[model samples]
Structure formats: structure tokens, C-alpha cells
Target: MTTLYLLGSAAPPVLEISQVIEDAQGRGYDVCLGLTPSAARWLAPQLAELERLTGHPVRSEYKAPMTADVWPRADVALFAPATFNSINSWAMGFTSSFVVGYAAEAIGKRIPLVAMPCVNAAYAQHRALDRSIAELRGMGVTVLYGPGGFEPNQPGEYRAEGYPWGLALDVVGAMVSPTT
Candidate 1:
């Protein structure tokens, strides 16, 4: 099975990540999860269960220098519910958070990458968001934004159930499948 690195940020939709992981598993992926520090804190109570579900540790911070990687090599990475900060940090090469840090390096490693942002309309209005999206796209990262992807919701009107996780998974599935 293809190893998928499902990375997430501190967004409302992250609360439903268990379903996303199960959905990916249903599509035949060996899922390993990573998260931003804030997201990890948000899901703290369920971290052990999530690790059990994925059969891999939920990594939020960087491991020790000489330690071996816990998760298998990722065939593809799907970063969803990417917060505004995470996106900008990744595009700017800030490696503070393990989620954004891995995503930034994944570009140079040529790992197939897909990203979907979960930002409110107010946050979307920031000029940096557009620039970051464009930068990620230029780096060969498939960003699912705009009309066909994640549409920003109004401030304080988070619609967690409406997050397009299936769309992101579909794209990742296509990436790892053999195309005739």
C-alpha cells in the first residue's frame, strides 16, 4: 500500500481528522499523521487513539538528530486544513513546525504534495495568503484552493463538515495510482 503522510494544521476541520484517516485507509493508503504544534495540542486527548488508528506515532515536533524515522517513507503528502500561519510559514521556508517544515522540504525531495487551506474570509483577504499559494504552486505543490477547492468561510462561521477532505484524498489517490 502507498504510504500517505496526512499533515494538518490548527483549523476547525482538524477536529474531524479521525474520519479523514479512516477514509484514506478505505482508499488503500497506509496513513501516517503529522500536525502543527497547535493542532497537536488541540487533538491531545485523542493523540494516542490516533496513533493506534494509524499504527504510527502522531509527530508534531522534530525527533532527535540520530533517531531513525518512525514512519515509513511517504509516497505522497496531503496537507489539509492548512491554517494561514502554516501556509505562510511553509512558503517562507520557516521550519518551526514539523508539519510546515516537512512540507517545505518535500518540495525539494520531489514528494508528491497536495495542500488545502482552511481559512476564514477575513484571513483570506490577507495579501500574504495569495502569495504563499502562488509560491507553493510554483514549487510544484498542488494547492487545492479557489473555486474547485477549499472556499473560505465567513469569519466565525466555520463549517467543519463541509471541508473537502475527499477531494484532497481523491487527488492524492490519483497521484499514486498507475495512469494508463
Candidate 2:
């Protein structure tokens, strides 16, 4: 089974991550979910939903040293609806939380990682965010979505809400496509 890691962020798009996991499972991939603390507050239902869909617990944080071993090796790691905080934290090498920690660990292992950042226009336009994006890119992370041009204000809503199927398909294609 192809192991796909779904990293969460503090945005409404994080809730939609369950749909992505369900779609991936339909395409015959096993999905695992990891959520940021703020993202967990916004979409608590996703934890249960993702567990039901993937038959695995949704990992929120690394509570103990041995906890990391329980996770399967990921074929792909995608951070959808990535928050500005998460982007900055990851870029600055902050791994105090589970999501950032796991991301760092995955990168060290050379896992094929992708991030889809979802932020409002103002946050996206921030100079710090821009620099962080550049740093992440320099670290060889594949950013899967567009630049921060659009804004989606409500929780559980997205500026590009209609394109989830396309996003999920893109993730699947990336996982299976051969690298030169």
C-alpha cells in the first residue's frame, strides 16, 4: 500500500483534507493524517473521519520517543491548507509540534513531500511568508498549489473549493509518476 501523509494547518481547507484522503483511498492508496494544534480545533471531526477512512489513528503530536516508529513509511507527504504559522515554523526549522516534527523527519528521510498553503491575501502577501516559501523551496519541498493570490474567509470553505478532485488527482499522479 502506498502510504500518504496528510499534514494539517490552521485553515478551513484543513477540514477538506478528509475528502482528499477518501478520494485517495478510492484510488487505492492508504492514507495517514497528522494535524497541527490550531487545525485540530477547527476540524475535530476530521480526526475520526480520517481514522475511519484509513484505519489508522490521526496523529496530532509526538507524545513519546517511540511514537514515531508506529507510523508507516510515507510514499508521499502533503500539507494541504497549510497555515502561515505552519509555513513559517517549518521554514525556521521549528519541530516542537507533531506536524512540524513529522515533516522534518520526512524530509530527512527524503520522502516526496508537497505543501498546499492556504492563506488570506494579506498573510500571503507578507514578506516573511514569501521568504519562508523560498526557503522551503530551496530545501527541495514541492509546493503543490498556486501562489497566495486568492482568499477564502470561512472555515470549511476555500477560494478553490470546486477543485478538490483535481487536487487529489494531482497528488495521486505525483506519487506514482516516475522521476527522471
Clashes of each: 0, 0
Off by over 4 Å in 1: 178-180
Please state the error at residue 86 of candidate 1 in Å. Answer: 0.4
Candidate 1 lDDT, 1-180, residue by residue in tens: 789999999998999999999999988889999999999999999999999999999999999999999999999999998999999999999989899989998999999999999999999999999999999999999999999999998988856568999999999988896222
User: Which parts of model 2 are misplaced by more than 4 Å?
Assistant: 145-165, 168-172, 177-180
lDDT assessment of candidate 2: 0.72
For candidate 1, the TM-score is 0.96
Q: Model 2 over residues 72-111: C-alpha lDDT tens digits?
A: 7778787776778888889899987898887777777888
Error of 1 at 121 (Å): 0.5
Residue-level error in angstroms, candidate 2, position 120? 0.9
